[model samples]
Target: MKTIKHFLIALMSIAAFTACEKDGDLITLSGLEQSELMATESTVVLTQETSAEHALSLTWTTSTLTVSDPTMLAPNVLSTTLQVSASEDFSGTIQESVESSLSHTYTVAQLNTIAKNLGATPDAATPVYFRLEASVGANMNPVYSNMITVNITTYEIDMSIGFILNSDQEATGATLYSADSDGEYVGFMGATAWYSFFLEEGDGTVWGNDAVSGTAFVTSSEDGSWNCWFPGQGGCYYVDFNTNSQNWSALWIPTLTVSGDISGELTFDRPNVKWTLPFTATSTTMTIQVSGTGNQYNNATGTDDEAAIDTPVAFAQNGSYVELVSQAGDITVTVPQAGDYTLTIDLSDPTAWTVEAVEGSEEPVVVNPNVYLPGVDDGISGNWTFDNALPLYNEENLAYAGVVNVNSLWGYTINIERDNWSDNYLLDSGDATSGTLVFQGNTNIPAPTAGLYLIDVSLNGLTYNLTALGNEIWVVGLDDQWNFNMPLTATATAGEYSGQITFAGASPWGFQIHLDSSWNRYFGGSSGSLHYRGSNITDDASLTAGTYTMTVNLIAGTYSITQ
Candidate 1:
């Protein structure tokens, strides 16, 4: 004889549980008062004397099912339960079945026990939430009443402390707990870039930066003190706030590179605050080493993120999402496969940073093209129209010369970067024939006439020689590798000629005038005198290393150097 009781019990609750109220069907909750559970005593103070006394009574009414047959009685198929919680939302609750009852009475001792179990502190009045749950046949189709609150004061005991922290004082914030109730509260807070905040003790005391300059000080309980802040990137930090000391501390983690057992270095994404390196693992898995400077223990001072950490690294470790420690840490995030992958270290958040491994092939390496100066040759451009410029001649040593096709008389500027206005060069003195050159100088030689010409400019000695290409006077001795040369315009008297020259060079300077590019015939003599190769003429006393005006009538044998 196989028993049928077991089978009937198993299928009783959900047995075709449907709304087909034909002859004798269950029509649950047809006419019930739509309200919350009600408590007779809304508040109570539990004591040893009142331990046995009734503290509170909770009652709720719910209809099981309604049917058309008036002669039939409602079946006792519905079950009710009593739920009590110390939270308004009842995020955590304690449930006790009331069988088929409609009301439950709690004694002082029983109510006190429930409150303490729900984390309510003794000797303080804490609000507890209560509601009734009605269901038919093994908790199917459960219906709940509105929640009610009952404030109860229990006996005394030790409870941990907590402090509220906020980005804005009057705005939303979170709480950090102190297990020992010692004023020091700790919690995980997301500190973002420039996330200035404050902390408030349970007694309504506010704490913040002490407003001191260059100090790791904090305000004891000042409402108008400077705002508090995180020292470094402020990514997710395991933060600690000490209400007594008024100071806070967290590891100062500086931005670092991600390397070790990888192909190359990763580039940092400034906008996203992350570093991503893509590569395939060499073996079964990949290892990453993140090593950098950080504060080990002491709170960072003004502008010194890790003045105290005072080491290459304070703390670190392996595994995903490792809390940054204030000691030497060896961190290696997981990369299961050895194939292609892109590893990323995200530090975008001011509160914390994260490491992630993404699957991918090798990303293309970008090569930035080189930037070159504009090319200019005298014939095509820069002939004098500002269309092109005369730069250093064939990368020569300050010998700026260009052959230009000129229809009329025109002047040109010279610069390494052809178009750079700040560095452009011009004649500082004299006419188109010859003169001194100065940086940003605004003078140009109005050459006697313009045809195909060679504009040779040397800014080293601040001089330029505009020669008619055919007639050129090679003035030597200005520079060892160069010449103190300038073109001399002829006079109607032929051998008796006059010209002007401006000279500047190192100390103990002298000069020799050559008639042609050849060193065959030269004149070396002091001012107002002339000599045919008679010992080199020198101005080591007053004329050397100084700017002077030199005017000479070579044939008349009269020259003057005016300082």
Candidate 2:
């Protein structure tokens, strides 16, 4: 009987332990209340002058929870997060979390930076919503505190018409320098004048009463003005002006000069002309007066007083200047009369320095003739036959251009000649179709492929280009006004053609390609790949009102559209 009673006692102990384990695994809180959050200050004004000592503080009441099974409420770690958002819905929010904190503090500067990062306008009051989130174990649901609203006013200095330097005497001479609230110097180093500020709408009250030499100052007016006067010295200077207090200061900046070879040559007189030193900051061109006796060759302008030469003129030194003369050279230039004359020389172009008689100029000057391109081989004729050669038109960019007809099976090369056979130029290496033209002595440049092409040749630079004629491949459709004349030409490459076209009023715009400006042979299809000599194909894809790149491959018989 004692043993039977012991077994019953053991059964009772096991039942109690199992009951405890079940309760511990499934614990629940019967009543939970959201925390109350409040800010020490509902509205705060922040400025650049505000410091971290004065910060915005927020405090929240601790949350209360009623556990259904108090024994299961053992010590549990919970996370408390403070979230700040631009909208009340908590969209686009920034959060800070801690293990357990009833209060949080943010400096005025920190809050201002946050507001700015949130795209708040400067000098404006913006509302920010703040709330708290409390989270516990996986079995428990998260809780949130009541949201609090904060109005933050951020201050920004008004710099629309701030400090300016009155350097140049002209009415619009002032150069504006933006200043901070404390009136610190921060700007680019350049030359500008102070008078430019006068054009602004503000009154004279902006100028300071007391002036500090070489310093910027603000006037005592209600709408004050800032001004700085640079000293007589020519150098870089840093100037600053305080908007709150009308005070300004200037700091001189030292500059180091490094000497190098002068770019162009100059002359003041015959034989002593070439002055290779750097020109003055005022101007790159210089002028000098020349005087000679009467009877200086009666050629309207006196012959002895002025002269031109084929070779570069020599320099002759005077008091502190020099004169340029073409004597002992190709051509001699003369002046109109025996009276003193002013000659202006510009050395901007080292190869061709312009010399003109500004004071007493009479006639225009003459120069050398430019080169030209005769033409390319059409595969039907010999390379240098002038009879069938197409004359290239000079287009001034060191380039000569012309168009020629070509065949598919036979390729041709370019033959460049200057007037006669004395100087013949050709590509040293590279296919004339699409590679660098390294000029070889009297070598021929073979064409990249056979097609009607527009050829451009640069003889001096040894470069040439062949583009397939656009007129050979026409694009027609309602999108392009159904104009058979609209065509896409081959780019720098051989068989690929590209051009941009707009689909405006046409709905579901479509187009077809024609070969050699004729409808006799054309391409049209809807399967990305083009069909030769097919019926008019409607585009499976629709086009809107926008520009698109239309590329066609003649060899592959394919086309593509890209916006």
Candidate 3:
């Protein structure tokens, strides 16, 4: 902190700055500048060698306390805003506020950003200014520290860099940052296309593609650099680059599919590095035959096709789980006959990628879930009260089904409505698709991907499967139109659905749910439950429809409509 002479208030007054402590007296803090801030270092040099360490730290004594009365408690300002700037007056610095903190540490990346914002060139010696401002209780005025100047020799390369973007030679507003200053930088960007781009350092250093059409992520401070393929086919991609490792990858896959013995596609969960497929094994031996399609890309060289499964994603048994390997070496293991399973492929660690098969029960196992679908229609965001939970009563076939919307951060479960979880439910394996269902397990079954899925379980088979479903479902058999009509749009929450329907005629009516615009798949059921192509859902005892709302949750395979 600068000397107190300029603040027009002596630092010694802080010791006696408390108010009169009267109930009616305004609790005012002493002055706008009442504390001395100390800096650990004033002159520093920033280099990649020292990037991981703090360049300097700013700390200040707490502000004077305020109290309405002697008997009342006094609390000092608990928040502080640290301002750094190139101009001594601080007209150009970025404002960073920290609560319940008294100190601010500077890292290379932060300083680098400030340097650019202040018009300081990388590797140039410059003076950066810092100050702290805070407000105490009821003090309309914020107390600020005396401005302090720090001389810093910026690193040659801006710790925070930007991309030139698809067609530009100059860096766009797309800046990426290294959280640890250890060379790993990650940033998210949405592009109509992200196939080409160049990395631009603060000092105007251009890092781009090498020859051979720039197919690799090979970048060095030498000759073969300028602009390169950022390693993705295109979409909003999560890009991670490490200057230390000189490697980078951008992955974005909106959907995935599994064919052959198991068939269907599922949504790709990018953050979790996983995609799931639920199906049943026809025999003890089966081969997963297919590839991934739709919007996706991989910028990692020689692995761009990784986005599409490349036709060689054969998973082999490896101890407790399975892993993707060359199709020629695809190994087989004993799979429970007619095993219902959820197949998951996780690529969080590109190397050692694993395809785990979470198995449920097989035919004749006699394992039944208390409820076919017990879930939170609003989603897992609130406390779930398995109220009116549906039970599996199809003893002849013992097949139960429903749609579950696991939301973004949670999974789903199959249980009944009872005071206790154990007594109300029968089995679950947090994310199990095939193996034996744990009896009365409290753990929820995690969706291979956190979203809407069609869950199918067979009691006698003791097997369960989850098929990913889109939100384009429609309402049929209403409005005297039974064709692919009346679209029930999807809500922000997957599987949880909503729409409106009008009946030109009569009371007791009926409707059916269509998976898509086609009649190839539709559902029919009664009493708040759904059935695949079963019968017309017309069991409502009293129904006089004018224009009613339709609420459907595929995850729970339930629906309701009313004015």
- lDDT of candidates 1 onward, in order: 0.53, 0.45, 0.55
Best by TM-score: 3
Off by over 4 Å in 1: 1-167, 170-194, 200-206, 210-216, 219-226, 230-240, 263-279, 295-300, 304-309, 314-333, 336-563
- Tell me the TM-score of each prediction against the true structure: 0.31, 0.25, 0.32
Worst 10 residues of 3 by lDDT: 1-10
lDDT of 3 by residue, 214-314 (tens): 23555554555544553323333446666666656654444445665556874344334455666667677755543433332334433244343322234
Task: Work out how many backbone clashes candidate 1 has.
Answer: 17
lDDT of 1: 0.53
Q: Write the per-residue lDDT of candidate 2 for residues 295-412, one digit (tens) a residue.
A: 1111122111232111222334333333334321122223444443334443222223343434442322211122333344435444434432323222123344444554422333
lDDT of 2: 0.45
Which 10-residue span in candidate 1 carries the lowest summed lDDT?
Answer: 366-375
